[model samples]
Target: MNREKLMKMAGAVRTGGKGSMRRKKKAVHKTTTTDDKRLQSTLKRIGVNAIPAIEEVNIFKDDIVIQFLNPKVQASIAANTWVVSGSPQTKKLQDLLPGIINQLGPDNLDNLRRLAEQFQKQAPGEVATQEDDDEVPELVAGETFEAAANEAPSS
Candidate 1:
């Protein structure tokens, strides 16, 4: 009888069913794009002037660690470091992601937009306009624009 039980236990382990065993798996995520109009309409339903940063597209990652400039977020994470893992649906992990996000405060979207505008302004040459396109003659040569500009006189 003891031998029979031992054989059954060995069989179970070989067949991949053992007590308290967890199968190793990698995390998977889905991504999607939404039109701004649809997004703002959804936010309107929630009575908030703006949507939360973490909810926006391209947010959240597993391999990357992000820091926030906001004091509230900086203080919260200062004490909490252990990650909640195992599964995305696991209540512990699910709860932790949002808490981390909130503590970090709003995503740096505003700062990002400001920086983008700054870069656009600093970009070389005058901003392209439809009027400018009309003012400039169509390309007559196969040479690149820079080559053509070099051949032409400076204003």
Candidate 2:
């Protein structure tokens, strides 16, 4: 009857049933605040103590890329990049999110300060206020607060 049917009849292809043979569609995801929390949790679980991306929450098209500085298991400081498709206010990227998050390392104070700088970009209609965090943060992978602080620029 049709090209696919002909192939199937010839045993050149494997059909699921006697009826339709089209593949099932994948589920589409919609981004949510829970997704953000999940992402944060995943990063935390993977030993990625600090996400160094302090840049504006820039979302263009359907992609979000964040870079954080963390110490590797080998005791070295490096920049880690995470590329996420979609946003809490935009699209949802579900399928690949979990696998991407599993690859995380550690954090530092300089990384946090750099990250904190980005909070200045207020969302539309959001009131701005300053609340300082003088306390040192919890360091992962045995990294010290002083080590992270040394990476920050003296104010």
Candidate 3:
């Protein structure tokens, strides 16, 4: 009877091991929508009004670098959050922004331009545009906003 019980326990353990190994690995889809509600609300509070289609909010050991569709807008939010009187320790927070902005390569630039266009259409008064400026940047013939954004990634 003792030998039969030991054999049954071993078989059960083996069966469970096989089941655990069969579990599927989930795909990691990076987007801002998955961020915590408080973080999202804070971003909205600072005038980063558009929903970022693509975002990389990496929390390093010492700093949290949030890369979103619009680096400029994200920078503005950081400024507003950090520069206010009686605000919390912002020096470290401020340190992360420049590096984060520097990483806005070609793919991110295009994303920002697309986000800017959407914001322009949704909130005309709030979003800035080259067309709205007194002095617009010159573009060669057959050039476009998308093309300019797609030209080269920033360092």
Candidate 4:
């Protein structure tokens, strides 16, 4: 019995134990949506080719920056369409201000300080009111303004 048990143990060790006969689970891939498929087909027909070897892409907004590392880019000059696909990291301009200031060095820093001081010294009453300006600004092409009644209330 002891000899038989030893042989069984050695066989189990060689064969990676009891569950080794079970097949590994298949990896599930993401299925593209109908819209994605349609867009890809349309792009192919329109001659929108992939722009390769793009290291990074940055999009700047009023107060934030969107960064994509190793993004895939595609563009068609005729269609005037550009597409960027990647995981984006959003960083606030406020968060980046310190780094920018450090890069500007001491001379620029002094000028910035002086400007800030001047701004602070100005009286609130002296600030320009909307009625004080007579110049009418020209509207840009394809620009439209929302009615004040339709605007959402700020918190």
**Judged by TM-score, which candidate is best?**
4
Regions more than 4 Å wrong, model 1: 1-78, 82-107, 124-155
Q: List, residue by residue over 27-75, the lDDT tens digit for candidate 3.
A: 9988866566676577666765433333334333433433332222233
How does each model score on TM-score? 0.16, 0.17, 0.20, 0.43
Model 2 stretches astray by more than 4 angstroms: 1-31, 51-155
Clashes of each: 1, 2, 0, 0
Per-residue lDDT of model 1, residues 78-133, tens digit only: 33332221212213333455555454435565554554585587556756667765
TM-score, cand. 4 vs. native:
0.43
Q: Report how far off residue 4 is in candidate 4 (Å).
A: 58
What's model 4's lDDT at 74? 98
Q: Deviation in angstroms for 65 in model 2?
A: 12
TM-score: the better of candidates 2 and 4: 4
Which lDDT tens digits does candidate 4 get at residues 1-155?
Answer: 69999877657555366556634467987677977999899989988989999977767686697878899999999999999999999999668667556656688899868756755776756875567467675564655576543575867
What is the TM-score (0 to 1) of candidate 2? 0.17
In the order shown, the candidates' Cα RMSDs to the true structure are 21.0, 18.7, 19.6, 14.1
Q: C-alpha displacement of 147 in model 2, angstroms?
A: 41
Ten-residue region with minimum lDDT total, candidate 2: 67-76
**Which 10 consecutive residues of model 1 have the lowest summed lDDT?**
67-76
Candidates, ranked, lDDT: 4, 3, 2, 1
Compared with the true structure, model 3 gives a TM-score of: 0.20
